[model samples]
Target: MSERFLTHQVENQPPSLLPYDAFSTDLPLREALAREGGGWAQAQVQAYGVLAGGEMMALGVQANENRPTFKPVDHYGHRIDEVEFHPAYHRLMELGTQHGVSGFAWRHADSEGAHVARAALMYLHYQADQGTSCPLTMTYACVPALQQAPELARDWLPRIVSTDYDGSHRLAWLKAGNTIGMGMTEKQGGSDVRSNTTRATPIGDGLYELVGHKWFFSAPMCDAFLVLAQAEAGLTCFLLPRFAPDGSLNAVRIQRLKNKLGDWSNASSEVEFQGAVAWRVGDEGRGVATILQMVALTRQDCLIGSAALMRQALVQAWHHVRHRRAFGRTLSEQPLMRNVIADLALESEAATALTFRVARAIDAGAFDEGEAALARVITALGKYWVCKRATPFVNEAQECLGGIGYVEDSPLPRLLRQAPLNSIWEGSGNIQCLDVLRALQREPACRAAYFRELLAARGGHVLLDAEILRLETLLGGDPTQLEGQSRLLAERMTLALQAALLIRHGDAAIADSFCQSRLGHQHGLAFGTLPAAAPTAHLLERAWPA
Candidate 1:
C-alpha cells in the first residue's frame, strides 16, 4: 500500500458518503486480507464500515428531517446509542442459550449494546472503502436463529456460512453464517444459565417442543436459534429455526426490540416461543460446554474488535495532540499532555500484546483444559482493561481538544460514549477478576504451572527475583503477616502475572523490551530500586556469548 493509504486520515463523515475509489490501491489492507485467505481484510473493513454507518444512521445522519426514528431507549430506559447493528451484538445474540447466563447475560444488558453500535459504524466505513458487502453480518444474525431451532440450521447454515450465495439483491447487511444463536436468557433468571426456567419436553418422532420467553433475543429476526430450556436431565440446548422447511414463520414470535444505550440501528428483541420446533446441538445436558464454543469465539472477537476501536481512538488522539495547539505550542509539546499520551500508549500496547498472545495461543491449538481456562480468564482481563482504559484515554484526548472534543463533530465524543461498553462487554471487570481468582484457587497447580511457564519464558531467575522484590515491597516483606492488607498486594501480583505472560508470548521483541523497560522505570519510581546489571545480563543471555 502507498504511505498515504497506510496512514490515511479518516474523515468524520459517515462511511457511505466517502469515495471508495481512493481505497482501490490500498496495498497494505489487501496484503493483510491475502494473508488471511484473500478476503479476510476486506471483510473486516467492510464489517467495520457497515457498523459505523449503522451508528451514523442512528445518530440521525441519514434520518428524514435530521431526526432519528429510534431514539436511544434501552430496556431499562437509559439513553444510549443504537446498538443492534453491531456485529458483536449479533454474535452474542446468535449464541443464544448455549452460553452461561452469568457472563453472557451481563454482556447483553451492559457492554454488547455499545459494541453493536460501534461495530455497525466501523463496518459502514469498511464497506464504503472496500466496495463490498460484509459476509459476517448475515451469518452473525442467522446463527442465533439457527441455534434456537435446529431444523432451520440445515437450511440456513448453508445459505449464510462462508459466502457462496448467488442471489441478487442479497441480504448484504445480513452477512453472518449458520450457527445456533444461543438464546440462554430467561425472564425469571438473573443472568445465570443454571437458573433458566424455560422447559423443553420430548414428544416422539425426533421432535422436541419448547415453551419460554427470552428477554434478550439480540437478533430475534435471524434464520435460526439455539434456545436454552430446562429439562429433567438439566439445562439443555435446543435449536429453533425461525422458518419451517418451506420458509414460513415457525412458532417463534418477536415480543419487541429493546431500547438501548448505544447501537440502536439493529434490533435487540424480546421473543416468545410456543412449542417452537427445535433440535438439540450436542448432548442434551451439555448445553453449557457446547455453547461455550461459540461464546469463547465471541469473547476473543470482543477483545480484538474493542482493541481495534482503541487503536482508532488512540490514532485520533495522536492526530489531535500533534495538530491541535494551545498556549503558544502544540498540545503534544506540553509536559502534562506528553504524560497523558505516554500513559495511554503504554496501556494500549499492553492490551494489544495480551490480545494477540491469546489469539496466537488459540491459533496454535493449545486449548487444553488449563490453557483454555487461562485464555478465557486472560481474555476477560484484556477486555475489561482495554475497554476500561479506552474511554478515559479518549476523554483525555478530547480534553486536549477542549470544546471541540465535546462536540458531536469530534470523533472523541463518540469514542468516549462507545469505548466504555467494552469493559462491560463479554463480562464485567469484577466478574473477570473473580474468574481469575477462581481459576487460581480452583486449579492451584494449573495456575502455578502456567505462572512457572511464564517465568521460564522471561528468564526464570530474573522474573522471579523481580516479582518477589515487587511483592515484598507491596506486602512489606511478609504475605502471611499482611493478610488483611493484601488486597492491593494480590492485585499487583495478578497484574504482574498478566504482564509476564504477555511479554513472554508477544510477537514483537522490540515491543516487549520497551514494555519491560517501561515497567522497570515504573518499578524504580515506586520501590526506589534500580536494576543496575539485569538488562545487560538479560541481553547477554539471549545473545551468543563472544
Candidate 2:
C-alpha cells in the first residue's frame, strides 16, 4: 500500500540522535573531566549525561516551543508581577538543581577541584538547553558575592545551595530553594556601572529604598537579584528580593519582557524600582568591586556554555554526515566533508580542553596564588575567544546538514542563535579584552601566571613556541599601543593556551592539526581548511567514536 502511495522514500535521511549519553560519547569532555581533577565526579556526571541527552533534550524543545509568558497582573487586576513558563521548563530546573548543577561546587567546597567537577556538570546541562543556564549560573555565582556580606550570606546562601527546585511564586525565605539574577545594566550605561543613575537612599538599619530602572533585568522570575545602584557613598550593591521584609510584594514593576533573538525559554525583562526595598550586600560605594567576583564566575560559565554549544553542534553534524549519503557514499566519507567535520572536532576539543583547564585553575585558586591569577586573566580571554568563535562554529555545523539545519525543527538554528549570546551577555568582546588588559596591568602575578602556563608547553610544538614568542614580543611593545591590539592579544593568548593544553593532554593528531592550522596559520579561514596531511578520519573518531 505504501509503495503505490509514496512519492519518495527517506532513505538517506539520518535518524534522530537523541537518547545517547552526552558525557560518555563526548571524548573531549570525558577526557577533560578527568584531566582537570574532576575524576571523582565521573559517576554523577555520567548519570546526568544520560538525562541531558535524553529527557532534557526533549524538555528543551518543549520549553522553547512554549516560551515563557509574563503575567504583570492577577486576574482581579492586582499588580502581581509573575512570569509563567511551560511545565517543561520547571522540570528542567528541577532536574538541574537536583543534579547539583547549580550547587555542586559550594556543596563540595572542601573537595579538591570542586569547581571543575561542577563545571563539567554545568557543561553537560548547557548542551541540553542554554536558556535554563542563566538562572542556574546566577545561583551558582552569587555565593561568593553574598559572602561579601556575612548577614546576607547567612540568610540566603543555604537556600541557594539547596538541591531543591522551588518555582512557586513566593518569598524566597518561604521556599526550600532559591534562584538569583542580575540587574546591572541600564539604557544609559551598558557595561559602565559608574554611569548608572539609579538612586538608593538609606532609610535605616542597612536598608535602602531604590528608585531606578534596569535596562536588562535578567531572569525576572528569580527569587532575588544582585543589583547596582547609586547610594549616598556612590555606586553600591544590594540584594533586591521579590518580597519585601514586611512579607508583601516589593515595588518592583515589571515594565516588559525583552523580545530576544534566542533563549526562548528564559525571560529577561526591563524593570522599574519605585521605592523598592533592598539590603546592602557589600560595603558602601563598592558595587563593582563586590559583584566582580560573581562576574568572574559568570564569565567562566560563558566560556563553558559556548564550548558546550560547540560540542553539541559538532555532534549533530557528525551524526548527520555519518548517516546521510551523497555522491555514492555517506557524507562523512567525502574528503571535503571529512576536513570540515575533523576541523570542527579539533576546535571543539580545543575549547573543551581550555575551558576545563581554566576550571581547574579556579578550583586550585583556593590554595594556590598562581592558579588564582591564571584563572583571573585566562577566564576573560578564554571567554572572549571561545564565545566569539561559537557563532561561526555552529554555522559551519549547520552547513554540514545543508537546508534542513536552518529549519526550527533541527537544533542547529537554535544553537546558532544561542552561540553569540554568551559573548554579549556578561560583557561584549571589547569589554572582555579590556578586562584581560586590566588584569595584566594591575596584577603582576596574573602576567606571571599567564606566561607560566604558556611556557609549560613551550617545546611541545614549534608553531606554538613561535606563537608564544610573538605574544611576548607584542606584549613587550609600547604599552600605549596595547589597547588597540587588545583583541588580537586576547585571541592569540587563548589560541596559545589551547594549543598548550592540547599538546599536553589531547591526542597527538589533534594537537598537531590544531597547532598547524590555528597557530601556524597553515589553514584557510573556513572550517574545512585543515592541511591535506591532517588525519581527518582519526580526528573524527576521537571527536565522537563510532
Candidate 3:
C-alpha cells in the first residue's frame, strides 16, 4: 500500500515531496537552524510532521485520490506565468525508527501527549496542502465555529486539531490547511482589526449569514473561514465553513491570489463571502481577545521562521565561501570574505538567541500583559532584523558565487527573494514599530521595567551614563533627534537595552565574540543607525556608549 501510494504522483508525475531526513544532525547551533529550515524552509513541514508521527498516518492510508481532483497548477498558472512542475514524484512514506520503519497510525499513540501532538501534525498537512501561510484565518474561523456549535469543536478538534490529515476526506479541501489563505485585511482596517466593514446578521435556524470581502487572505480557498464581521453587538468572529458536508463550494468565492515575492508555494488570495453560513466562536464583544491569542501564536511562528531563514542564509554563505575558490585560494580564506562570513554568522546566532529566549519565556508563561506586549515588540524586531540581515548575507553569498549566483537556479537568489517576505508578512516592520510604541504608551511602568532590564543587562552604570549623555547630546538639538520621535527608534532602544541585559544575565554561553560583535552591529542597524565602516566604534559612539 505504501509503495502504491508512493508511486501515485500528483497527476502522472512522481511526487516531489521530500521526507524529513536530517532531524538528528548536530551542526553548530546557527548552522543547524539554516540548513534544517531557514534555507530549506518549505521542507520544515515534513520535519515537524515526522516529529509528531504524521508520516505514519500517511503510510497507513490506502493509495487513492479520495479528495477532489483540483490541480493547484490550473488555479495558480492563471496568476503566475512561471510555475515549476517536477517530473517524478513520491509521497511521504513510513517513519523509519531505530527498530524499523512503521506506519504513521501505528506510532500515533507512542508520544507523550500524543493526541495533541497528532492534531498538530494533521494541522500541518492540511496547511501544507491548502496553504501554509494562512493559519491565522483558519484559526479565526475555527474558534468561532466551534464555539457556536460546540459539537463541531468536540467532533473536529479530536480529529483535525492535532493532525492535518484526520478530517473528513470529503471536506478535506475546506479545512484550515486546505484553503487559500484567509482574507482578514480590509482597505481601512490596517491591523487595528476593530474597524472591519464585513457584516454578519443572524438569519433563520442556527445559521447566521455573512456578507463582505477580505482584501488579503493567505489561503482563500480553505475549507472554512473564521471571519471578523460587524454585528448588532459589535465586531465579532464567525466561523464560515466554505463547503457543504458533501464537499462543494458553498457561498465563498475566490477573487484572486496575490503575486507575492515569498511563500509562493501557497496562495495568498482575496475572497468574497456572500451570505456564507457561519456560527459564532465566542461572545461577540470578546472576539478581539480570542483572536489575539491566535495572532500571538502566528507572530511567534513568524519569528521562528524568520530566525530559521537567517540561519539558512548564513550556512549557505559559509558553505559557498568554504568550497568556492577565487584568486589563489578558497573564498573563506580571503580576509574580506572571512570578515563578511564572520559577521553573517554572528547575526544569525544573535537572532537565534533572541528567538529561543522568547520562546522559552512564552513556554514559561512569563508573558503577562506587560511582558506580552513587550514580547510581541521584541519578536517583531527579531523578525525584522533576522530577515534584514539575511538578505545582504544571501547577496554576498551570491557575490562569492559570482555569475553562477545571478542565475535563478542558484539557492542564493531564492533565499534573497524569500527572506524579505518575512519582514513584510505577519506585520510590516513599520507596523511593528508602531505596535511597540503603543505598548510602551499603554504600560509606561512595565515599559520602564523592561528598559531597566535592558540597562542592567548593558551594565547599569554604563547604560545610565550613556542615556544621560544621549539626553544631553539631544538637548543641543542634533537633527538626528527627530528620529528619536519615531516609534521604531524608541522601541529599538528598549530592545537594545533589554538584549544587552539578556546577554549579561541569560544562561546561554557565548561561543564566539566575533558573532557577538556582529550582533552588536546588527542591533545598531535595527535601531536605524547610520551605516559605518567600524561597527565596534559605531556601537560605542552611537548605540550605547558609556
Candidate 4:
C-alpha cells in the first residue's frame, strides 16, 4: 500500500549519524589527548563523547529548533528581564556542567593537563550544540577574573565550580551552582572597551552602581556578568549580579534578545543597566586588563569551537559519502570525492592538532613563564586562522554532499551558520591579528616562545622549514610596517604551527597532505584539490576508519 502511494522510493539517501562514539573513533583527538598529558581523563572524555554523539545531539536539535524566547516581564507586570529556553536547552546545559564543561580546569587545577582535558570536554560539547557553548565557556573563563577580588572569588568560586546545574533565577548565593556571562561591548565601542560610556558611581564597601548599555550582552540568563564601565579613575571592571545584595532585582534591563545569524539556542541581548549594583573586581581603570584574562580563555574556546565544527561537518560529509552512492560506486570511492574528503580530513586533523597543542601549552603555562608566553601568542594566531577557516571548510564539506548538504535537514547548514560566529564573537579576525602583532612587537618573551616552538619542529619537512624561515623573515621586518600585512602574517604563522604539529604529532598521511596542500600551496583554492601525490584513500581511512 505504501509503495503504491509513494511517488519514488528513497534509495541513495544515507541514514542520520548518531549514537556514535565521538571520542573513541577520533584517532587524532585521542592521540592529542594522550600526547598533551590528558591521558588521565581518557575514560571521562570517552563517556562524554558517547553522550555528545548520541542523546545530547538529539537534544541540540530540539534546543535550536525551539529557540530561546525573551520573557521581559512576568504575567503580573513585574519586569523579569529573563530569557526562557526550551527544556532541551536546560538538559544540554545540565549534561555539560555534570561533565565538567564549565569547571574542569579549576576543579582539577593541580592536575597535569587539566586545561587540556577541559578543552577536550568543551570541544566535544560544542559538537553537540554550538549555541549552548556560550554560557559553558564563560562560566569556565570567569574564574581568573573573579580571583582578582578575593571577596568576590570567595563568594562565587564554589557556585561556579559546582558540578550541579541550577537554572533558578534566584540569587546566586542560594543556588547550588551558577553560570556567568560577560558584557563588554557598547553601541559606541565594539572591542574598544575603553571607549565604553557605561558609568559606575561609588558606593560604600567597595560596591558601585552601574548605569549604561551593552550592545552585545552575552548569555543574559547567567546569574551575573563581568562588565566594563567608567569609574572615577577610568574604565573599570565589575561583577554585576542579577540580584542585588538586599534581595531585590537589580535594575538590569534586557532591551531585546539579539536576532542573531545562528546560536539560536542561546540568548544574547542588548541590556541597559539602571543603577545595577556591582562590585569592583580589580584596580580601577584596569578593566581591559582584568577582563582580558577571561577573554584569553574564551578565545581558546573559540579555536576549539571552530575546530569542533570542522570535525563535526567533516564527519557528517564523510558519513554521507561512504553510504550514498553514485556513478556505480560510493561517493567516497570516486577519485575527486576522495580527494575532497581527504583534504577536509587533513584540515580537520590539523586544526585539532594545533588546538590541543595550545591547550597543552596552557596547562604547562600554569607552572612555566615561557609556556605562558607561548600560550598567549599562539592562542591569538591560532584563533585567527582556525576560526577564519571554519566557514569555508564547512561549506566545502557541504559541497561534498551536493544539494542535500545545503538543505536544513543536514547538519552542514547549521554548522556553516555557526562557523563564522567564532571568528566574529570573541574577537574578529582583525582583532586577533593585531593581538598577534602586539605580542611580537612588545612581548620579547612571547616572541621567543613562539620561535622556540618553530625551531623544535625544524627539519620536519622541507616546506615547513621554508615556511618557518619565511615567518622569521617577516618578523624581521620593521614592526611599524607590518600592521597592514598582519592578517597575512598571522595566517602564515598559523599554517606553520599547524604543519609543525601535524608533522611532529599527527598521522603521517594527514601531515603530508597538509604540508603539500596548505604550506607548499600545491593545491587549488578549494577543498579536494590536493596534489597528485596526496594519499586520498589513506587520509580518508585515517580521518574516520572504515
Best by lDDT: 2
**Global lDDT of each model?**
0.47, 0.93, 0.47, 0.91
Which model is ahead, 3 or 4, in terms of TM-score? 4
Q: Per-residue lDDT tens digits of candidate 3, residues 424-492?
A: 666676666665556555666545545554555444334333553453344236544443464435434
**lDDT at position 39, candidate 2:** 92
**lDDT, model 2, position 12:** 84
> Model 2, which residues run further than 4 Å from truth?
1-4
lDDT: worst 10-residue window of model 3: 80-89
lDDT per residue as tens, model 1, 279-324: 6666677777666656554555555555555554555555566666
Give per-candidate clash totals. 89, 0, 42, 1
Model 2, 1-546: lDDT tens digits are 768888886678998898999989988888888888989989999999999999999999999999999999999999999999999999999999999889999999999978998999899999999899999999999998999999889999999999999999998998999999999999999998899999999999888999999999999999999999999899999999999998899999999999999999999999999999999988999999999889989999999999999999999999999999988999988999999999999999899999999999999998999999999999998899999999999999999999999999899999999999999999999999998998998999999999999899888899999998898898878889999889988999999999998898846788898999998888999989999999888888987876
Candidates in order, TM-scores: namely 0.64, 0.99, 0.66, 0.98
Over 1-546, each residue of candidate 4 has an lDDT whose tens digit, in order, gives 768787986789888778899998788888889999999999999999999999999999899999889988899999988888999999999999999999988999999999999999999999999998999999999999899999989989999998999887899899999999999999988988789999999989888999999999999999999999999999999999989999999999999999989998899999999999999999999998999999999999999999999999999989999999998999988888888888898888889988998999888997899999999999998899999999999999999889988998877888988999999988899999999999889999999999898888888789999988888888998888999999999988998888888888746777777888898899888887999899887878778875
Clashes of 4: 1
Q: For candidate 2, which ten residues in a row score worst on lDDT?
A: 2-11
